[model samples]
Target: MDSPFTSKLGTNYCPTAEDAVEIQAFLAQPLRQMECLDRKIAELQHALNKLLEEREGLGSIVQSHEALLSPIRRMPADMMQEIFLACLPTHRNCVMDAREAPLLLGRICSAWRALSLATPRLWASLHIVDRGEPPQRTGCGRCPSMARTGWSVPTIPFAAI
Candidate 1:
């Protein structure tokens, strides 16, 4: 919606230096009238803030309902598991890095974590190149043992633990 405090400047809106001078003169031409405009401006600002809060609330409600309509919510668990399995590296092995796909799958949602962990195929192929175990809290929050024991197959840590 257009702002309630519609600018006095018209649709044409081409102000010259003379126009600026004239406008300043007009604003001060009436004593205490600027104070009235200020009050109106404050009132409009309050109304705008309230509208913004209301819009945020309305958006949240819409967001809450959006989950129910998602096709992902309706997909069969078996189908999702198949999809998750396909996401794993076929020729090479998967790194334990949280940034990559198979590992990243678990962190996305509880259902995904369960599937990724349960599917033995997802863990069957892994090729890790650990720069080094990250120091505690350096980043990525409590890093997992990546390529530990010289990358002799992680043995499906997600499934095991």
Candidate 2:
């Protein structure tokens, strides 16, 4: 596979017509080999892309099935309600902020929202801060009216408390 041009490479020597013909013949085999390599590389790249797509599809399936086995989804409603109740502040009444529980519990999922709202005890006590603004009486439809005297006077039933 040696070329007559090999010894003459990197020199200013001009090739004769016969030397030029020999150089072209010498290059043919390597050029065909390079073309074969390029085709193989393209085929391997297509196979790699297909494998990556299959892996991504399998990952999505695994994630969805994993959600079905979550412990929270299996817990009984009564137990979940107790956990929600425990999240309430013991030192003081629950605040209207979403950062705290009761309100935070309602934001978790639809089932929890229904349970938290259905549980009247969770909305039993609310510490209202009068920031010189009129109070908004928007709680579980059972929220008593706020007296218009700039004071939050909740007349919640004793049973709800």
Candidate 3:
């Protein structure tokens, strides 16, 4: 019997059994490609979700740090001074880095830098020790001599020394 589906060239387009198999195989290629694309989309969605979650966690941490910093900014000047004084090292070390003090204090903010600079006693204590032979007896470590003048004082505040 002649198939209804026919090309202008008179070929039977309503496939025979063998032809049906080939047609099904050809159709399966697109299905397989679609499945692969679906899997990739799902993986991308999971990755995006994970990144969003991480961003939220980091945002919360930033907010917490900002909240913590706000109180320090609002602190009374006199009280802040006391806190800065209390934060000073009790012992002076000859091998100290003047850079270290400002660096640590600067971690807070500009106000901290000003406060630390204003406190002369905070930089006054110098206790340089020479476990080995003193290099020159005139200078400490890599710190500049100008910064070391505070240490030259015979005695600093007892709390500071």
Candidate 4:
């Protein structure tokens, strides 16, 4: 029962060989336990890595299924066509601007583009203005904020007219 710290005047008593042997045995048990714990930690780390890989694989599968679940993909072609027709801009004159409604619809996706092009009604609405005609001065959208946002109405090219 000797304390860890001792004064210089304290007895420097040494234990017997039997006592030393018992202490060594006591320390060996804990050493073996520590080795067992280390093995378990390694096994758990490997298991965690495997679980993460499994989760990633499942996530990709889920994402693909979710893409298929999209409402737009499920819409009937006739209904979708009606919706596309409904999206046409009402105020446009006979100008051919790419950023305009009918043209912009084609830029969306291959499905919408095919639908837009196939639907003669959408193209038939185009009103061609003469190149000599002046543009609407009121709609210049020359406000500093509008110009900064790059949202100004795109003008139809004179050559395309």
Candidate 5:
């Protein structure tokens, strides 16, 4: 069998000892590197084809052009009010801690923002039950008198209602 180096150099041109050693070292490295590169390329191509096939199968469920908005301009006002009321606290003294969540909801779009701000009842109920026992007299929440009175606020306090 003809070696690669033999074919590259004419038979009359014999390599010096140093040249032979350099050529052997260079060839040995590239053979291992080429094998590693070929294996990695095959693995990547296989993964790419699998992803392409999966994406093609999703159809309208994954369609990029689908509209994000509701088909209607407005839902009935009474229904909206009922939904908001459903979220209200059933007991007195419950403070609505939903301020952050509602603000985030409103930020999604102009209509949602307007609706969230317009609905006062939605922000009315807060569950003081989650606030834990009234802290001892030393220091606690902003309502020091509330802790001193030992009068637990109901889910929706009368003052808030």
Candidate 6:
């Protein structure tokens, strides 16, 4: 672009009315171009945000579908039962805490909960820490059959000590 002013632009230079008008006109084109570019950038940023949200939704669906194909989900009920039994403490009876095997196993999923509840051996032994409130019924609530009929594995034996 050619200079609109005849003299070189410096700190000491003072603009006349003509020079001021010319300066405004010279800056107008570039300023409008900058405003147009800003609008375009905002539109692109909005589009990018929408695309990112769609990607997140698709990713969540993929993860949930993948969980259905897990190897543990395919294992036979008997094998899962043995795995649950193995998770029990050998030295002492299982506690009521949700962190340990018997309680934790049931909390895993609906299939595991059904398996754990059906397998009486998992509820065979329990260490009840009485807080010195009146004793409730002495039966395993997890397995209603065991609680009512007292049907459990003879080898493991039920204990509430």
In TM-score terms, which candidate is top? 6
lDDT of each: 0.68, 0.74, 0.61, 0.64, 0.55, 0.77
Screening candidate 6 with a backbone cut-off below 3 angstroms (N, C-alpha, C), the clashing residue pairs are none
Cα misplacement distance, residue 129 of candidate 5 (Å) = 13
Measured with C-alpha atoms, the lDDT of residue 120 in candidate 3 is: 55
TM-score of each: 0.61, 0.59, 0.45, 0.42, 0.35, 0.68
Predicted model with the maximum lDDT: 6
Per-residue CA lDDT of model 6 for 21-106, tens digit only, reads: 98999988989999999999999999999999999999999999999999988899999989999999988877767999888998
Sliding window of 10 residues with minimal summed lDDT for model 3: 152-161
Candidate 1 global CA lDDT score = 0.68
Write down the worst ten-residue block by lDDT for model 1.
142-151
By descending lDDT, how would the candidates be arranged? 6, 2, 1, 4, 3, 5
> How high a TM-score does candidate 1 get?
0.61
Candidate 6 deviant stretches above 4 angstroms? 1-31, 136-150, 153-161
How much does candidate 2 score in TM-score? 0.59
Clashing pairs in 1: 93-126, 93-127, 94-126, 94-127
Give the residue spans of candidate 3 off by over 4 A. 1-69, 91-103, 130-161
Candidate order (TM-score): 6, 1, 2, 3, 4, 5
In the range 20-96, model 2's lDDT, one tens digit per residue, is: 89888889999999999999999999999999999999999999999999999999988887888899888877666
Over 4 Å off in model 5, which ranges?
A: 1-74, 99-110, 123-161
**How many clashing pairs does model 3 include?**
4
In candidate 5, clashing pairs total 15
Q: What is the lDDT of residue 80 in candidate 2?
A: 84
lDDT of 3 by residue, 43-120 (tens): 999999999999999999999888877767788877876776576565643234545553366456777877766655
